[model samples]
Target: MQDILGHLQRLGMSGYEAKAYVALVAAGRPVNGYEVAKRSGVPRSTVYETLGKLVARGAAFEVRGAADATDYRPLPPEALLDRMRREFDGSVDALRDALPAVAGAPEGHLIHNLKDGGALLDRAEDVVAGARRGLVLSVWPQEMARLDGPVRAAAGRGAEVSVMAFGDLGDLGGPRGGERIYEHRYSAPEAVLADLGYRLLVVVGDRREAVVGGFGGDGSAWGIYTADPAVALMAAEYVRQDIALQILAERVGGDELNRLFATDPGLLRLLGRR
Candidate 1:
């Protein structure tokens, strides 16, 4: 019983409130401050104060009797939990509504030159960390390793993640449970190699908005952060195109295509096989 009081306190209940409520529930009757204090091991002088606090917090109710005595009764455990949940949900909604006017902010854009070394990696992380909805990306080993944390963070936040990589991008392993991964040999006839030359892109989009970035080896990167319907539609189209291409290539001849790709020494080396 004492441990139960401590458990309630650990769960964010005030010590006196926890004690008073536990006493009331155990007595299974409307209990006066003196009886509550004696049973709960609370100091007699502070028992009424504790009961008052419990009443204020909705953990217990005060009932008036004909003889000028007031009795306290604890709410049921499930009732208390339900009320707490409702209060928490209401608080969250209110906070969200108030935050926009107080610390509200807008979308951000950043650019980096690849020659900047580790800074390029940091910039990629920043982009992925801020993403919502989904991420569609094509990247190389170095860049992929750098952005791994941020990518997982996005996925943990409920963003859909699909990654296409050339060479090793760390085994498609991540903490977000799972990720949709596409691996290809960069030396293939396709101009859009998973790595080298072209650029690294991370696009996050929802039904109404999107954020897109173009990053490349030259240390040059560009971003368009927008919620405009037209921009989102155009960006979504490209995402659809990429998904389609991945499906097409995989379906056309996954094993045969990979075999042909392996023949290229440069690609095999990039893929860390040679």
Candidate 2:
């Protein structure tokens, strides 16, 4: 019952209206205002008013008998949901067609913090899907797995896609086929994970926007999404540097790369310890 009320509330029903509708739906027959008030625990004073609203919204209909009394029956759940879906889609289409011309232009530089992993990845996917020219990303396998489809779609549309993957790409579900779907470079995940104690993910799209975030061992995830050109440039450069280092590592070999890391105090400090 509580879950039904929650869903109804999300669909724009007031608490009283949701309660009244649920009561009617559960009754499975026409119910008078007083009976609805008793069954739904709504106040008698508001029961009729709330039912009237439900009828106005097309979620309920009034039934009149020989006497002057009125009763209400809720629309079937499936029918109600279908109606809501059609109305919602129509509103979205209308707004999509009308809004851009009337809406004021946006100001430069926007940044938003996404405090959940799902939201962060959703924004990342949107960024990738909207990319026109190119995308540079530094990601863990888990995030890459979630974003693979959007990334591939972008690349298929002629966007250049480059990926610097931490950990084994195979572990994160391996390579996605198709030309230029992923131009990838491998990096030891532990190299950064050991220092940060978390997994980092970054995406820069079309050199215009970026999202950078990390997931921690404690199951917390966070990200900053921004359209600030400077921030996007920095993120793009970070991925480029990682790609460059991978190239250098390939040329010098792993043993020589290890030696360089051992001898370089700056690089060692950056890695969190010597």
Highest TM-score scorer: 2
Candidate 1 colliding pairs, count:
2
Q: Clashing residue pairs in candidate 2, if any?
A: none
Per-candidate TM equals 0.46, 0.68
Tens digit of lDDT per residue, candidate 2, span 7-120?
889879999999999899999889899999999999999898999999999999999844878988889999999998998899989998899979887886889999899999
For model 2, state the Cα shift of residue 99 in Å: 3.4
Candidate 1 segments whose C-alpha is farther than 4 A from its true place: 1-12, 64-68, 104-132, 135-254, 272-274
List clashing residue pairs in candidate 1: 113-219, 114-219
C-alpha root-mean-square deviation, each candidate: 10.9, 5.2
| Worst 10 contiguous positions by lDDT, candidate 2 | 177-186
What TM-score would candidate 1 get against the native? 0.46
